[model samples]
Target: MATPLTAPTTDPGCRVLGLRERKKQRTRDALVDAAHRLFLTQGYGRTTVDEIAASVDVSQRTFFRYFANKEEVALAVMSDAEDYFIDCLRRRPADENPLQAMRAAITEAWLELGQDDQSGPAGVTAALELFELLETTPTLLAAHLRRTTEQEGVVAGVLAEREGLDAAVDLRPRLLAAVFGAVVRLSHLSWTSDTAAHAAGPDGMIALIERHFDQLGPALAGSWR
Candidate 1:
């Protein structure tokens, strides 16, 4: 997963930060990196804020300064990816339908994420390991589901905007978003269980996601004989 903290600046107007801000950024990044390593090695349930902070040689209070709690820091990587995915969806061409926009957006998002893994702080291997941990960890999985439900509303609003439809009155956007979210959840579950997919990493997961999306129409409309 691309550590959004360390992602290269793409904005032409990006300003050079002062020393204090740069130092803070470094601290936050260190905390996130330490948290991920501890979570993966010792298990999220067993890892605590103190241990993460200690690993980064910072006070526990400093960890709380950047993240609300262990869960927040633990899921920061996934949150960054989600934010990027939404941004990509918003940038999709207006002519494409909601489903097409979503499909293209996710593909684009994953491709960029994969590229970042090769050169970024946490590679795809760490990402896949973290993903498996998230799926198996009950508390994290529940929190993830709750976050996904909320994110669906945001996605639906984006879809509604693209179509010039009021999401409050029009059910299509919300309904489609729900279905898309479900498909993604199912794909995650499938990928987590498939040993071969684990070996294939991001590319394999992307293929599985595409396959799930392709099956959506047939799975919904066709009779199982």
Candidate 2:
């Protein structure tokens, strides 16, 4: 779900439309911005595709050209962050253990996202806003859960590939991935609590993750306070 904003075309013919491509990129950005604002105001279910397009002064056809549906647009920014996390996971040091790799990769991904790039501060704020929306919206929450489950399988496959094991045959990779996913879910749940002091930004989320991860060993050991 790479946005045209940062995606470079490798096709030779695409080189000819360098200026044209820039214009299209601007359109894509405008549509995404409009969609986010509309969704925030009208709610996800109430926001129609036509209205979103109308907000950007584009036709529904143009919106369809950039995004297949409202869901795609709603999740597009978060999707980019997810993609970066996966890529970071893949590039982690092979010698590291699974948990260590996961932590390091995620930390790097968060750090990278905090930079002055496309999805920097503004995008982080937008993502957090959408996350809060998803939490309260049943439809979007279900979709988010489904994506989380699917991502666990994808990550398990990546782990299996790294460990030189058949993902279908080796249960260890899948088991570890599931456990890791649960940890992430729990961390998010704790961090999202109304009384939680975390900033709701990249740094705050990272701190919550690290804190929860640090507790995994003690929890497994069944140590009482």
Best TM-score goes to which candidate? 1
Question: What TM-score should be assigned to candidate 1?
Answer: 0.90
Lowest lDDT 10-mer window, candidate 2?
Answer: 4-13
* C-alpha lDDT of candidate 2 relative to the true structure: 0.73
Q: How far is candidate 2 from the true structure (C-alpha RMSD, Å)?
A: 4.2
Model 2: per-residue Cα lDDT over 101-209, one tens digit each:
8888777876766553344212565566677788888877887788888888988988888888998998988888888888877766665673442455657777878
Model 1 lDDT tens row, 78-196: 77677778888999999999999999998888887787675333555566667788878888888888888988999999999999999999999999999999998788778888888
**TM-score, model 2 to reference:** 0.82
Candidate 1: stretches off by over 4 Å? 1-6, 10-22, 118-121
Give TM per candidate.
0.90, 0.82
Cα error of candidate 2 at position 72, Å = 1.9
lDDT value, candidate 1, whole model: 0.81
Off by over 4 Å in 2: 1-26, 117-122, 194-200
